[model samples]
Target: METVVMRVEELQLGKIVAEDIFANTQYPIIYKNAKIIHEHFRIFEMFNLKEILIYKEKKLEVLTEKQIEVETTIIKLSNYTSFETDYYDAIAQIKREFGNWQAGAKIDITKVRGMIIPLIEKVLEDRSYIFDLNSYSNAKDYLFHHCIATGLIASIISKKLGHDRGTIIQVAIAGMLADSGMAKVAPRIRDKQSALTEIEFAEVRQHPYYSYLLVKDLPALKEVMKVAIYQHHERLNGSGYPKGEKMSSITNFAQIIAVADVFHAMISERLYRLKQSPFKVIEMIKEEEFGKFDAQVVQALVDIVVDLPIGTKIELSNLELGEVMFINKYAPTRPLVKLINSGDIIDLAANRNFYISRVITKEY
Candidate 1:
């Protein structure tokens, strides 16, 4: 009998592999034509097995579950599909409340916090899909894309740092509301076309302080809420405002929020500036601003961005178009690509090889 196996993405469409049916009885099935899809299907079925063998090419052995827990965490991120509408409404409401906090009486920070926690857990359960911040739009949609993105990043970082559930939630909540003050800023300044003057910048910096004040009076929110509101802007270099806090003074929870905030801001398209490419932003964070961010946290973000599937169409450097096929973790900017019209994957990581030169520009 011919052995059959399916790809991970195909599992969602109900694809089946007849020959691999018997393999299901065993833990960690191996197949010559195995795909990550089989492992995902197994996960969807809630099978508590580890590892799946996809295929072996020359010296390369494709094992699907080395970091099984991490991979599983990534796969569960798809749950956001169900909560998109709720997220959208939550953001819209938050934005509106910021515009006129009195219009809605008092903003229900506790209620909003409750709604977002589960979403964060879902993303934590599946880190892979959720970490693909580049593919998501950061527009002014009512959806919780930003919250979800921040939550995912926070969860990943929290897990890496061995943070407990309570700590993780605190970080996630901070991430969700990091921009709550944006609503308080004048609409024109928030939506300005050109760079802001020193005054405008100062006003923007006041957001974190304003957010802190907004929640300072709530007893239930005294602990977690204040952290989220205040620390989102405190940076490592003491350059961040409201307070010029250095890394030593910054809380770990606050640091996580800062990374999430910066990452989301870079990937998201704003009214004044076009979105910065994820890989490019990662590189920038690593170089001149090295100590400004936690090195491990930045690496986690880079790993997530570099591993995006090859068939994903992306706007590239010099206005050329290509689809990512393979990622060079060491050099994310130069991933292997297959031109839109071409059929082969070009490994840009190969030095002086016939690969597309330059990085993916932010013009798109």
Candidate 2:
């Protein structure tokens, strides 16, 4: 029988696997010709069995035995510990403060360090586990995700520079609270989809200063913590807001937060525009704003996203579905992909026969 390849999108849920869909995971032949209505499906759940052999032909053909590999790769990638229970609790408290910022409820700046430090240590220890906050689909979840991502990135940088644990935690807290001033802005203005007028942009730029002023007088959070609220927006080229201080004047802690903040914002889908894919965003950072960010820090981030695992589903330039099987670490934009229907894994990095035109959707 001539082998026929089918895209996962083209295959129905009930369609029997003409061949072993994968070595470890397999589906029953009864699903042959079954239509798939949803874009996302758990292969294990759909099979109703842990593993089975599947054939790709029109009829059922058991090719080989299979096993379901239970691995918490994502969870294990980050060094999660039960010790951070209090940290998680602190974030919930901070979120509550954000809800009542208008009623004169102040964010507990001292408590911020406790929650942010361990998260940063985890990010530094295991680069793979830094969740991309910008990848979230819902705008309502952005605030929490942003805080997490920021803390993770900041902590990684601090550890790289050999900062002590106490100092690293303080810096991470700064990164987490960098955008606290946004709470003061009206939801309508912050969530507007259209281009902001000059007045609006000015108001947006004042958030860092406003945040600094709000907590600058607190004795517990007087000096170091203020950096988190004030200097986050400052850039090395003096293009950033408030005082327009040059890069030399910004603290190393603040610089790390700035990089993380910009990265999260660029990749995150926003009301005003679609989010850029991780590779594309990294490219823009390297080409257009290299001077604005620490080169070592940016390179570390680039390395993390470029080497994401194979079998990861991604949106392609043609609005088709595919999985990453290989990556050209040197040129991350061009990666080897296996088209869902074709099951043909093409190595764009080597074949030179095809090119990845563009990225349609990012892998979360």
Candidate 3:
């Protein structure tokens, strides 16, 4: 870690002091190893301190440079353990359930709940599992990864919105079953790489209705659950197919699923296209899909994503590597990275050419 007297103009967010930064006033201590946030820039100047001793990286984060080795081991353990355990089976079941629905078997709400509840409990009890959700995205079968990621994402966003356990559980349940009706469409069309013809697009739009029909008759489902299934594809702009309902007509549960679905779809690899970076996708959701989706839901998703712990190793698009020095609230995908070889700190947001290509520990 470097210690230097940096001018006020050079200070940026998340700069931590190596030694105590004294002020003129009555405050007890501007203690050593204390981290500065966005609000502290003014506090430094208020005290009339023009320069302060700062470190190359903050010391207060739960993660540390020394601890990164252990965290990497833990991540490697997680991938193997989760793959062998029921985690893989849970996603496998989602795929099977979709096939069962298409085969004229009824929607088994009890079985679906049994599959979703354990995962929801895992994420709820430990929020760090949110980071693992992206790792769980696999390309072997889109629906398997899609449904599982959808549920985990739903619970996270639901809890962000302050929904109770019951609601969160239900949203999780709805998430797993949200796209089940895709089974009704021919696999060839669903996996088509090219733009769909008008007829194919029309067929694709019916999946939500098909999903609604499968779940609507299940007495085990709550009203909100059924509605989430039905309306997940409906947009506020009246551009969505089936009913083409507007903003006021859609329920909040559906809005949550809609956001999660779009996010999972974009991140997970598909036959049609390559996956985009999560940060870029989030930017698109906000900038392009404005009136088409609920803003609150999108913000909740963004809030949940930017919590990437410090010390995480990340890869850039050009194949260079770096470790996360700090998380920037203004831009998440573009966190402060201290390059391993150069020891130079980079603010990813400032450098537009380099976007985080992957989270090394979190992805294979």
For every model shown, what is its TM-score relative to the native structure? 0.65, 0.62, 0.75
lDDT of 3 by residue, 1-364 (tens): 7787788788765567778554432222256776565335544543456878877654535444445444322222243355335567787787788788778898888888878787777666555555545556565577777877787788889999999988898898888788888888898888776899999999998998888888888877788888888899889998775799999899899999999999878776676667766767777788888888888999999876665555667777777888765555557557767787887767777788887766664444
Error of 1 at 353 (Å): 12
In candidate 1 the C-alpha lDDT for residue 127 amounts to 54
Best TM-score among the predictions, by candidate number: 3
RMSD of each: 10.1, 12.9, 8.6
TM-score ranking, best first: 3, 1, 2
Give lDDT: candidate 2, residue 348.
52
* lDDT leaderboard ranking: 3, 2, 1
What are the per-residue Cα lDDT tens digits for candidate 1 across 130-243?
A: 434545556554124565567557766776677778777767766666666566677777667689999998898887876666666666554754775687777788777677
Candidate 2, residues 164-283: lDDT per residue as tens digits? 877777667777777878788777767677888888888888889867766776665538658756988877888877888786688766777887787777777666567666666777
Show where candidate 1 strays beyond 4 Å.
1-80, 100-105, 128-152, 222-225, 307-329, 337-341, 350-364
Q: Best by lDDT, which number?
A: 3
